[model samples]
Target: MHIAVILKQVPDLVEEVEVDSQGTDIDRDSVKWKLNEFDDHALEQAVLLKESSGAEVTAVALAADGVDQLLYAAVARGVDRAIRVTTASARTDAPAAAAALAGVLADMGVDLVLTGVQAVDDLHGQLAPILATRLGWPHVSVVSRVSLEGTEAEVTQEYSGGRMATLEVDLPAVLGVQAAPRPPRYVPISRLRQVMASAELGSAAAAAAAPALGSTVTRLAAPPQGQGAQMLEGRPEAVAEQIVALLRERGLVEA
Candidate 1:
């Protein structure tokens, strides 16, 4: 079987975020980019499948700064192929990304497509469902595990309240992976460097343009700071009395 994993780059959250001059997006130029954490799990699931079932795994991503290194790391982690799509856009634009990827993936002949269930940057919509809609393929979200037998795939979906359901789908389906069955393995930086030197990533032109969403961001600003936390250092009874008095002041309790 052939599996294709979708990878995305996200801004490292450790850095301070600044709004762009347009007031519609973050200042991408000011931040460093890294692989999406959820996508890392998706890649790990794909690699696990490749190891267990002898499936061919392909990692696909859009061209961006540090994306080549991400692809090389995927190679070191057991991806058989890597393809970079030629396009430029703010990573938050999920609709455009889904449209572009759907067009390109149409001709790949892959049996399964795996993507993260959600991304920190993609607040518009998750990519996997939208991509599946564009491709007219079956899609399942919040999938935690996947296993294949013949032309059918069994997947475990996690739901709220600590619930899980297993379902089976025929081949040529897309899954929004919440997690892999196991934690993602670590690849040595030296191995990644070697792959970077030896591996060549395939490139493809985006076959479709991103469609416009029906809305626009007119303004962006940081949230206003609130009063800092109050420390309660007293006896248990005193603390309880203080908490009840505070709640009463806020009308949270009957005074």
Candidate 2:
């Protein structure tokens, strides 16, 4: 089986974030970059599937410069090969990103594409579905488990209210891996170094074919400052009355 796992390089949560002088982009110099946390689980799943079924795993990333660290990390984690699609644009819009990925997958003849439910930075959670649509493949989102048998694959999906539904999908499918499915394996430093030194890393030059399929983002702004807290005084009943009144005023409770 040939499995393709999509990965993204994102700003490390541990590093402090700063907006650029123009306020339209982040300060790249100050931020430390790493693989999107959820993508790590997706990569782990790919590796596990390869180990159990003797499948070949290919890890792909669409990123700008300075993403070698993230790609090296994926290699260390057991991905058989790595491909980087370099984009000059700093914008991380989901549709445009998905279109680029679809192009790459088209060239690679991917049989299965696995990705995280969402990336931490943008948190759009749209890539897998968008890519599936673009590629004309069956898509299953929030999938917790997947098992391949013969030409079909069984997927366990998590739905609302903690419910799960098992589905059987044919080959050439896309799945959005949910966080609750399974814990990703840890990559030891020794293996990391070995893979970093030995893995075949390749890059695809940015496509100049046409303008991005779609673009949006009229304006960007920071979140509003939080308000100061207020203390509730008096007896429990009195405080309850105040809370109810506040809730009613805010339209959270019918009065």
Candidate 3:
């Protein structure tokens, strides 16, 4: 089966982040980018399927600061091909982004599509389902594992409250990868360099992409700094009294 893996580059939270003066979005300056963690898992799954069944795997990403780095990385990890979808802005709206992605998948006529359950930047967890909606295909979310069975797929889905169920799903479907069947295999830097030199990455613009759904941010603000705890080191009785006094001072306890 031919598979398409939707990819995205997200802010690397390991580094410090800043907001722009407008306070409506993150400041792109000085921001480090990486593949969304779950998308890495999805890529791994696609590679695994490619290795075992010789499935043709293609990866697509939206235009962004580090998209070429990401596409080359996918190639180094054994994706058969890579495509970059052009976007008007670095921060494409979620619904509009999904529409563009769905447009790509439909054009490719892929049998199945895989993507991270959610992106770190948005955490909406809606892209794959939206793709399914746009394509009128079956969709599943929070998938932990998948095994192909003679044109059908047996999938293990995880739910909150420690619940899980395995389902038999038909093809031409979308899966939101909650966890990869295995930890993503690392591609060597040398291999990435080799792929970058040899691979031909394609680009496309989604003709059907539309304006994003109505959502406006009035302001963006940093969270309040946390207050360090005050340790009351003393006798138990003294500590208890100090706690009560402190509570009283704060009006947490009656004087």
Candidate 4:
């Protein structure tokens, strides 16, 4: 089996984020980058499947600035090969990105493509389904478990209302994995250094040849600040009344 895992490089979750003065994009000068957290789980799942089923796992990424570190990490995590789709802009919009990826996968002839359900930085959670639609393949999102038998895969996914469902999908399918489904394996320092030194990282030509989807960003804004908490003081009955009044005032309770 030839499995392709889509990885994304994102701002380090630990770092402090500040919007650019224009408020159009993040301030890149002070930001640190790392592999997308959920993508790590997707990579781990692909590696585990390779170990168990002797499948060949290839890690692919839409190469943004400062993505070499992420490619090395994927190699250390047990991806047999790595491909980078070099692009000038790190567009966070999922559909445009997926369209570019569809072109790359078309040439690679991948049997299965796995990606994180959502990127921590953007949380779009739409890439996998969009990619599947572009490729005309079956897609399963929010997958918690995946088991392969012969040429078919059984995928267990979480749904609304805490519901769970399983489905069987054939090859040439896309699966969007959630974090809790499988914990990521640690990449030893030794292995990490080895991959950094020896892994073959190349950019596919198709990525450059593909036309831009012409996506536009009208404006960006931060969420409103949270209100200060009120302290209820006095007797138990008085405090309860005050709490109820506050809830009602905030439209959180019926009057």
Each model's TM-score?
A: 0.87, 0.79, 0.85, 0.81
For residues 24-108, write the lDDT of model 2, one tens digit per residue.
6678788888777777778888887887788898888876666676778877877888888876665565676776677778778
Candidate 3: deviation at residue 64, Å?
2.0
Residue-pair clashes, model 2: 0
RMSD of 2: 5.9
On TM-score, the candidate that comes out on top is 1
Every candidate's lDDT: 0.89, 0.78, 0.85, 0.80
Per-residue lDDT of model 1, residues 11-118, tens digit only: 888888889999878888998888888899999999999999999999999887788888988999999999988876544477888877887787788899999998
Tens digit of per-residue lDDT, candidate 4, span 96-187: 57867888887888889999888755534378898899899999988888878988889988989999988999988999988535588888
- TM-score, model 2 to reference: 0.79
- Expressed as tens digits, the lDDT of each residue in 1-255 for candidate 3 is 899998887788999888887887788776888898989999998898898888999999887767989999999999999999986654555577787777778888899899988886663336888888888988898998877777777888998899999998889899989888799998899999999999999998877745555667877777776876878999999999999999999999789
Q: Least lDDT summed over 10 consecutive residues: which range in candidate 2?
A: 208-217
- Give the local distance difference test score of model 2: 0.78
Q: Judged by lDDT relative to the true structure, which candidate is superior, 1 or 3?
A: 1
| Alpha carbon lDDT at 148, candidate 1 | 93
Question: Which residue pairs of candidate 2 clash?
Answer: none
Candidate 4 positional error at 36, Å? 1.4
Better of 2 and 3 by lDDT: 3
- The clash tally of candidate 4 reads 0
RMSD of 4: 5.5
